[model samples]
Target: MTERRHDREFVRTFFTSPTAVEGEDDSAKMLRRAADLRGLEAPDVWVPDNEDATAPSMREEGAENVAEVVADSGADFPGEIHPRVVWHRDDPAARYRGFQQMLTVADPDRGAVDHIDGFVIPEVGDIDDWKKADEALTLVETEHGLDRGSLAMSVIVESGEAELAMRHLREEVGKPTNSLERLFLLVDGEVDYTKDMRATTPTGELPPWPELRHNTSRGASAAGLIAVDGPYDDIRDVEGYRERMEANRAKGMTGIWSLTPGQVVEANTAPLPPETGRWLLSAGDRRVELDDRDGAWAYDGDRLSLDETGDDYRLRVGGDERRLDAEQLREELLGLVEYVPSMSDVVDSMEEFEAARESGTGAIAIERAATLRLDGVDVEISSDRMWDEATYQAAMTPIRLFQDVYDHRPDQREELEERYGEDVVERATTVG
Candidate 1:
C-alpha cells in the first residue's frame, strides 16, 4: 500500500480566509486571526487566500501580508499553511503574476520560507499545465536556494480538462524529471467547473456533481493524495454542510472547503466517529432514531407489529411477516436498525476482541441483546457478531483517525481529553 505523504495526513478541514482586505491598518488582519486559531475552530489546512478571496487590486498586498503574517505567527499556528496563488492556463499574464507572487512569499528574506508548506495553484488546465505549475514552483525553489521538492503544490480542479488530467497523475509521478512528488492535494472547484461546462440549473444552485467527487476520490487514492471538496456557499446552513460532509466521507473524501471558522469546526468534527452510539431504525422510505428505554430498546413508531408464536416471534412490516427465534429476532431487528458506534463503543469492542484473540481464540462472537416494547408489547431479542483478525483490523480505522487528529491538533488536546476522558483519550491517541 502507498503510504500517505508524511506532511499531509488527516486533512478533515480546509479553510480559506481572505488575505488582505482594503481599509485595514494591517492588511493581514484576517490571515493573522486564522493563524491564531486554536481548539476545534482551527482547520487542518489553512490557506491565506490571495486568488478569489482577495480583490484584484489588493493581491500584491495580500501576498506581502501572507509572507509577513505567516513569518510572524506561523510557529504558533497548529495547522499546515498553504497560500493560494492566481493562475489560469490560457492567461499568461495571470500566470506570471501568480509566479511573481509565489516568489515574493517564498523569498527567504521575507522570513516566511520556513513557515510556508507550499502554494495552491488555481485554474489549471491539462497535464502540461500541471507540469508547468510544478516547474514554476521548482524554479521558485531553486531561485531561493530552497531544497528541491520542498514546496508542495496543490491544485484546484476547475475545468473538464483539469479533471481529465488526474488520470495521468500516478504515471506522471513516476518520472524523475519534475517535482510531481511535491503534489499533495486535489481540491474540486465546482463553480468554475460549472461555468466551464456552461451547465445550467433551474434552482440557480450548483449541482451536487457526486460523480466528480467520486472521481476526485478515486484519483487521489490512485495518486496517494488527499481530495478536498469545494466550498459550501451557504455559510449559515450548518446542517446542510454536515450532510454534504457525511456524503463526501462515504466517498472517501474527508476534507472540505470551509467558508468560516464555524464551518471549520463543523468540518473538523464531521469526519471523526460520533461521540455517542445510537440505533437508526429504517423501514422502506422511512427512518427514525430508536431510543433506549431503561435497558429495553423501545419503539413507539407506527407500521410495525410484534406477535408471539409458541416457540418463535413474528414481526410484520408493511406486508411481510417472518417468524424468528429470540436470537433471530435480535438479528432481524439489528438488520432493520443499524448501530452507529461511538469512539468509546468501538474501542471497547476492539479491546474485548483483542483480549479474546490473545487468549488463543481465533474468533469471538459479540452478543447484542435488548428488550423491545413496541405498542406496549414486550419481546426480548438477542444476536451475535463474530469478530476475528480481519474484523479487528477493520475496527482500527476510527482509532487510527483518532490518533491522527490527536497528533495534528495539539491545540485541541485538552478539549479531547475532557470529552473522551483521560483513559480513552490516551488509548485512542496511542493505539494503532
Candidate 2:
C-alpha cells in the first residue's frame, strides 16, 4: 500500500518568517528551496529566466540575514527593495500601513531587489497571541487585494493561541472574512504538543474558533490544516515528521513540510494504497481513467506557453483541456505497485497524478459539497488509495498554469527519471 495519501486537493504554499528577528534578512532563500523540492519554481513574475539565480545570491546566515525573493510574471515587487541588503524595521518600508509586500527576485531589466509575492513584516514576537497578531492579519487580508475565491493565505500560528488561530481559519476564510486559502501553521520550534492540549486543540471541534467562516467559494479547498516544524526531520528521524503530519491530518490538516526537496515526494505522497487495488487501476468497480498529458503540449493547438494555464486536450479518454478524475486517481494507485519501488517514492509520485485532475475542469462529487457546492452527483473516492488523499481533504489539487509554466530542463528531468526510474511516469506513455 502507498503510505502518504491525503484528502484535500486544492492547495498552494506560502513562505514567510514568524518574525524578522534582528539581522535576519538572509532567511527567505528557504522558500526558493521549498519550491524546488516540490518540483516547482517561483512564478515568472517573481524571477525571470534570463536573470542569473545562482546560489551565491541567496541570503546567508548573518547577524540579520535579510532574505529576498525576486520573481517574473509581470508582477513587480509592489514596493522598492534590493536583494543586496536586508530590510530591517528601520527601513522606511515598515512605516506604511495596509501594504502587501513582495520579495525582489533577480531581474535582468533592473538592479533593485527582484521580488516574489511574499508578505512583508517589520517584526513579529509571538504566534499564539491573536490579540496582537490580528492587527497585522486583518491588514494583510484586506490589503492583499487577492481574488477571494482563488487564493490561500498562510497564517503563522505559534503563539499560545495558535490553535485558536487555526479554528478561526476554518470558519473565517471564504466567509464573512473571505481572506484565507488554507491554515498552514508554522511552528517555529520542536515544542512538543503531541497530545491535543488546551493550546494545540484541533480546529472545528465543539468549541470552534471565533467567527467561523461558513460561507465557502468555488475552486476552493476544504479547510485543510497542517503543522510544519523541526529541522532535517528526513535524514535523521523521519518517523517523528510522519507522526506530526499524520497527527495534524487527524486534526483536519492537509499537508506538512519536509526538511529537504528529496523528501517532498514522500512528505506529499501517501506511502500506502488499499491492498485490493494494489496492482490495477480499478478501485472496486471505479474507473481508473489515465490520460497522456505528461508530454509538452499547448492549449488551442498553439503549443503550451509559460503564460497560458492549460487547454483541453481530447485524448483517448474524454477531454476538457486535461483530466485526472476518480478513475485516474485509482489507476495511479494501482500503478504504484508496478512503478513505485518503496513506500516513500509511492508517496512522492502522488503529486504528478494529483496534478492531472487540475488540468481539466470537472464537478467532482466530493468537491461539489466542500469547495464547489456541486453535490449534484454522488461521489466516493475510497480510502483504499491512502496515498491519494490528505486525511483532512476529500478533493483533488488542480493543475495551475502557474506550476506548468516551466518545463524541467532536459538534464534535470533526466536526473529525475534516474532518481525515480523511467516507470515513474505512466507506462507505455511517452514523456519528455
Candidate 3:
C-alpha cells in the first residue's frame, strides 16, 4: 500500500506550566523534564493565566530557553522536537503577537525554529473560535513573511459544539495551507455535555457519552488529523487511565494528553501495532497467479501468498516470506478477520472485554463476552465457505463455538460438541 503523508507513529504530549516561578525558569525546567522522559515526543508549555503578561516577552523567554536547551543537550532523540506553546484563547490579537514573537525570536543558525514548534488553542467550541484562530495564524504568517503551514497547530474539542466546529474546520481550512494538525478530546467536557442535556444522574453515573468522543475522533480521522485523548484527572487511578487510553487508541487516536510526568511513561509505552491485514498486488491492475511448487507456493510477480498446507505455513509478502506456526496463524487470522464486516462487530465488542479486564470489572467481561458470542453467530453465517474450505473452517469454527457457548442453543451446542468434541469447544469458546 502507498504510504500516507501524515501517517506517523504514536505521539506522547507532556504538558508543563508556561510561566516561571520565583527563582526557577519554567521553560528550562520543562526542557530538562522532557529530556529525562526519554520517549516523550512533544512538550507543550501552557501560556500564563495572568492577562498582564506580554505575549512577546513570554515568547522571547520560551524561545531563548528552547535554544539554550537544544545547544546544551546531546543528540539523543531521533526526530526534530518542537516545544509547542499553548495559546491564550480569549485574546486573539495576543495569540497573533505570540506567533510573531516566535518568528522574531527564532534562530535559524541554532535551529531554534526546529525545536520550538507551534501553538495549541484550548477549548475550541464554535465557528467563531475557528475563524479567530485562522485569522491570527494568517496575520502571523503575513507579518513575519513566513511560508504557509510553517507552524503546527492543535485545537481542544471540549464542548458539545466541538463536532460542528470540527466539521467546519475540515471544510474551510484543511491540509496544505491549514496549520491545524491535532484535535484533543477532553473527557471532562462530557460533564458539561451532560449538564446541557439534563442527563446528569444523582448517583454521579452519567449516560454513555462515549458517542461524543467517538464522533470527535471519527471526524478527526476522516479529516486526516491526529486525534488526541485528553488527560485523565484521577492521577492515582493509573489502570483506569490506561484502559481509557487503550480504548481510544483502538478507535484510531494518535496520542494521549498527560497531567503528570509519571503518566508519560505509561502513555508512551502503550503498544501501537501497525495495520497488518490485506495486501494488493499486480502490475497495471493485472492479477498475479500463484503456483504451488512442491510444498511451497510461488507467485508470478513480486507479490505475497500464504502456503496453507503445512502446520507451519509460510507467508510471502513482496519478496519476503516468514513461517507462521499454528499459534501464530491463529493470531494472524484474528487480525485478518477484523477486515470482514461480519466479524467487525465481534472485534468491536472485544474492546469492551479488554477495557473490563483493565478496570477489574469481571461482570462487564461476562456481559461483553455474551454479546461477542451472539455477534459471532452472524460472523459464522456470513463468512465465505466455498473457497479453501480448510481455511474457512479454521476461521469460522472458533466463532461458531463462541456463539454456541453464550447463545445457549442447546441442540446446536450438543451437535457441535459431538462433532468437534468437548475439549475443542471449550478451548475455542474460552480463548477464541
Which has the greatest TM-score?
A: 1
Model 1 compared with the native: what TM-score?
Answer: 0.93
lDDT for each residue of candidate 2 in 291-329, tens digit (9 for 90 to 100): 212321112222211121133212222221334455553
- Candidate 1 vs candidate 2: the lDDT winner is 1
Best model per lDDT? 1
- Summed backbone clashes in each candidate are 0, 82, 0
Query: Worst 10-residue stretch by lDDT in candidate 3?
Result: 369-378
In model 3, which runs have C-alpha deviations exceeding 4 angstroms? Answer: 1-19, 25-27, 40-90, 93-101, 104-111, 142-145, 174-209, 273-432
Better of 1 and 3 by TM-score: 1
TM-score per candidate = 0.93, 0.36, 0.50
Number of residue pairs clashing in candidate 3, backbone atoms closer than 3 angstroms, sequence gap of 3 or more or interchain: 0
- Report the C-alpha lDDT of model 1 over 1-432, residue by residue, as the tens digit: 456765556688889988899988887789978998988999888999999999999999999999999899998889899999999999999999999999999999989989899999999999999999999998899999999889999999999999999999989985887778888989999999999989989999998889899999898988889999999999999889999998998898989999899999899887777777777777656777778888766777766777877888888877788888877877777678767887887888887887887799989988766676766767666667888899988788667777888877888888787777888887676554
Give the least accurate 10-residue stretch of model 1, judged by summed lDDT. 1-10
Q: What is the overall TM-score of model 2 with all chains considered together?
A: 0.36
Task: Flag clash pairs in model 3.
Answer: none
Model 3 lDDT at residue 295: 28
For candidate 1, the lDDT comes to 0.87
**Clashes by residue pair, model 1:** none
In candidate 1, stretches whose alpha carbon ends up further than 4 angstroms from where it belongs are 303-331, 356-362
| Model 3: per-residue Cα lDDT over 101-145, one tens digit each | 455434455555554444455545576665566556566556656
